[model samples]
Target: MLNSKLLHKKLFLDSGLKTQVKEVNTSNLEWTKNFGDIAPFMQLDLRLIWRNKRTKSSVWMLALGLLYGLFFYPNPTYNNMPFFFIFIGIFSTGIFLINFGQFVPAWDSGYYKLLMSQNIKYEQYLKSKFTLMALSVVILFVLGIPYVYFGWKILLAHFAAAIYNIGINTHVILWGGSFNRKKIDLSQKAAFNYQGTGAVQWLIGIPLLVLPMIIFALFNWLLSFEIACLVLTVMGVVGIVFHQKLMRFITGKYLESKYKMIDAFNQDN
Candidate 1:
């Protein structure tokens, strides 16, 4: 019976609702009934990411980061690379934040709802998020970093930033989405403080870009270079360790609470 059901699902997916039914009557193997059915939906989530222009903003943002690095990188001829790494490494945070922010709402409205409602585990969803995030960061750095930091710092800084980014801000937005309890209709100006969604995106971007620098710069001032880097390294570790706590907080608390609120608004349409 399981095979019978699953085969029906795959037939429906590969062909169409009407055609699959026509074939299912004759076929005993059911491919569609299993939880494995969600695999295609998961792949679709990533493929559909590009259709979203806001998410792709990371590409242009990286271009700008590279341009900024071109100007800001320490003069190699003068042997000032360490200062350059400190500055540019901090600057890269902005790029990562901007990239992460682009996906917050899309996750809220699109994939989060789908995954949470499905039988799929949040663990799988996290894997997808990290995978996509990794690809996005790699693409961004490949485009931005070679021009800025040389051999070792580039690699070290990339991993360091990825750690904090995946740990903190990515988790925050997910946390905020649930904790915020607001459906956030981009069409409605009032939902986002009368400024519009563009304003909200900008607001999110500013902090993503600035927060780490503030952390690093303040620490850098009080301590030596090695200590400051060590602190950020700790944040990177925190990102990996506590990600599940952050996701659960978002899903169970904030997101579940807003179900009725969003339902009421969406029902009218």
Candidate 2:
């Protein structure tokens, strides 16, 4: 009876061992890519974008929209429709872009260290940033339609122009975002002070939201919406591609010289 019990215990132990081994082999950690090629950037960006109130750059836009709806644009007619639609596009896109910036660490000497710690491929990183930007643009494009009281004819033109504006802002943000040196946090007292960007940074971002308005005014002035959209589309495609090339070049330079900066910051900290 004792021998039989020993044999049974041995069998149970062996079975337990096998199950443990199988679990280890099938664990989520064993899976390689957490989020695919663009996962790192997207993950990083998404985290950073919503970490603070200022990160809700969309708030300012919402305020502007509410103000407009309440004051300047209570009801919609053909005369005010153009301005209303353009405002909607700008504010909407601005919200996404604002939040997108929050995800990015400032491209300062400090951020270079974090970036270099990994073996991330440049193209993959760039693609990730581009994809996020596209998502934001799509959100604005879709949402702006409701605010604008126009048919698909006008909608299509605004869509193209708004997308073009997103492209332009993406390129611009990439340039500014490459040097993040600030720590991102969503909580603290004296809340505004804890946020990284200052008034100047906020001012710079204004243009991104304002581009749609500019385009609308220009188109309105010319009295040719289709031609204006074509021009904006051409500009958007060219600008976005050009920014990619520029990003590649700039990052290469920053990578080459960024080591010393990283070392200094690390040593100081």
Cα lDDT listed for each candidate: 0.51, 0.56
The residue ranges of model 1 lying beyond 4 angstroms of the native Cα positions read: 1-42, 52-55, 59-62, 74-87, 90-97, 100-103, 107-127, 142-159, 179-207, 264-269
TM-score of 2: 0.61
Residue range with the least summed lDDT across 10 consecutive positions in model 1:
187-196
lDDT of 2 by residue, 34-100 (tens): 5476675666655544444544554345444333433434444644456455555444555555555
Best-fitting candidate, measured by TM-score? 2
- lDDT, candidate 1, 1-269, per-residue tens: 99999987777454567777786665433332243543454464444444444444444566665556556445465233443454465456446444544444443453345444666554455444544554455565566545434556544555556556656666654544333322333333222142213334545544455676567667767985556666776886787687767566655654455555344334322
Candidate 2 C-alpha RMSD relative to the actual structure: 8.3
**Each model's backbone clash number:** 13, 11
* C-alpha lDDT of candidate 2 relative to the true structure: 0.56
Q: Give per-model CA RMSD.
A: 10.9, 8.3
